[model samples]
Target: MKMNHGFSWQYDEFKQVGTDYGSKAEVEIYDSSHADFRDMEAESIRILDSLEIKRSNVLIDFGSGTGTFAIQAARRCARVYAVDVSRAMIDRAEAKAIKAGTSNIEFHHAGFLTYEHNDSPVDAVVTTFAFHHLPDFWKGIALKRVNSMLKPGGQLYIHDVILEETNAVENIAALIDKLATAGGKLLREDTERHFRDEYSTYDWVMDGLLSRSGFTIKSKHIEGGVLGTYICTKN
Candidate 1:
């Protein structure tokens, strides 16, 4: 994938947002810290199965942290293009892919607004916990770009921190408390920083973005009013 230079007013997706994934130290402890809350392997398997990924399909994974989901997807698919903005994260992910002996996965140090997919349209595009880096306007633009990268009726799976309009504040606090209980101080502070600084928007806004950007939402699920998952198909 090539990197596209946008207009001067365009959002700088490569810039470090709320979380400094550019830090090598942060990259090192990412999996361990997230493991306390998320089962990456199991989540990857579940998502792959839900998407009906096949041996002959090609897919793109945006914000492919540490290559966990990319490696798992490569095992079941023909090829996986794993992309990230942070060079540190990409380095770690590439190293993990090599260690796992997965050669079908390609690592690209790019982000939502800059990554230019030149190959034939892919079967699916998956992004997890990364879309919030972009503000809502740029998010809509990014989704349009993602739509162009996919084949007709291609799938898109997005999992991120999204909020419900009602009880948004209380839900976020409860979610933070839950993370703190599960992963201690590190998780608590992390969650706080995410909501405090990131661009997580209401569910209605996300739905509007997807729909107006050329997708039909197949399924939308929100857990505990903080995490959102959407399975959509290109229209």
Candidate 2:
């Protein structure tokens, strides 16, 4: 699909705030820093299992980060597309793929709103901790593009920080305090910056966006009143 030239209100996802992941040094430290809280490998396997991915299936992981999930997915699927907005992240993920001897994974330096898939429609799309980069409207557009890239009944798994509307202020405050206790002052500051600067929206908003973008929510889980995981299928 061709992007519209006349559209002028698009968001630039590459221009990051709170953290600059474009630097090689930052990319190098990403895994270690996130490892304290995220067991990404286990999470990847869980997603694959949930999707019932077959050896013949093709998968695309948006915001592939350091390629941990992409490398693992490549081992189980026919092909894996690892897409990220940062060139540094793409380079690091490619190196990790090489080290792991996984050759079926293709790396692309792009984000949710910009990445275009020209090959056959994929079987599944997986994105974790990344969708909040876009504001709500662009997120809807991104979801439409993702839907276009998938065959009918294709699965999409999204894991990110999504807030609940009920007592949202208290929930966010409690989450920040909990994170601070678990990971120290750095995590505290990061959580503060995330709320202050990021685009994570309420659960109701996300539900509306997903439904409007032609996805049927098969399952949804919310953890710690903050993190939300939605397993959806293209309708």
Candidate 3:
């Protein structure tokens, strides 16, 4: 699909905010920082298992940071597209994939609103902690684009920080405190930056966005009243 250049309200996702993942230093520290809260390798395995990935399947991973999921998925799927907005991230992921001897993965320096999937419709698309980079409207547009990239009944898995409406203030505070305890000052500061600068939205809004984007929400799981995982199928 051609990019819209005319007058529109779409947000430019490439604009850096608090943390610039494009920086080599940031990319280098990403895995270590996230390791405080995430077991990325195990997470990749779980996502692949959830999707029931096969040797013949083609998968696309949006914002595939440091090649964790993309490299792992490449082992099981026929081809894997690792798309991210950061050139540094793409470079790092590519290096990691090479070190692992996984060559079926193609790396793209692109974002959700900009990446074009020109290949055949994929079997599944996965994005973790990345979709929130876009505003709600752009997220809908991105989801529509994702829907167009999938085969019939294809799956889209999104894991991100989505807020719950009930006691939002309390929940967010508790989550911040918990993260601080688990990951120390850096994570606490990161979480604060996310809330202060990022665009994570509410569950109700996300539900509507997914439905309007021609997706059937198969399951929704929210952990610690903040982290949301939505398993959806293209309608």
Choose the strongest candidate by lDDT. Answer: 1
Model 3 whole-model lDDT (C-alpha atoms):
0.91
List model 1 lDDT by residue over 30-142, tens digit each: 99999999999999999999999989999999999788999999999999999999999989988888999999998899888888887899999999999999999999989
TM-score of each model, paired residue for residue? 0.97, 0.96, 0.97
Each model's C-alpha lDDT? 0.93, 0.89, 0.91
What is candidate 2's CA lDDT for residue 169?
87
Model 1 scores a C-alpha lDDT of 0.93
- Order by lDDT, highest first: 1, 3, 2
Candidate 1, clashing residue pairs? none
> Relative to the unseen true structure, what is the C-alpha lDDT of residue 9 in candidate 1, on a scale of 0 to 100?
83
lDDT of 2 by residue, 1-235 (tens): 5454456766777887656678898888788777767788898898899999999999999989899999999999999999999999999999999999999998988888888798999999999988988899889989999999999999999999998888888889998898788778877888898889889999999999999999999999888778999999999
Question: Residue-wise lDDT of candidate 3 within 103-210, one digit each (tens)?
Answer: 899898888888888889999999999998888988988999999999999999999999889887788999899889989998899899989998999999999999
* TM-score of model 3 (CA atoms): 0.97
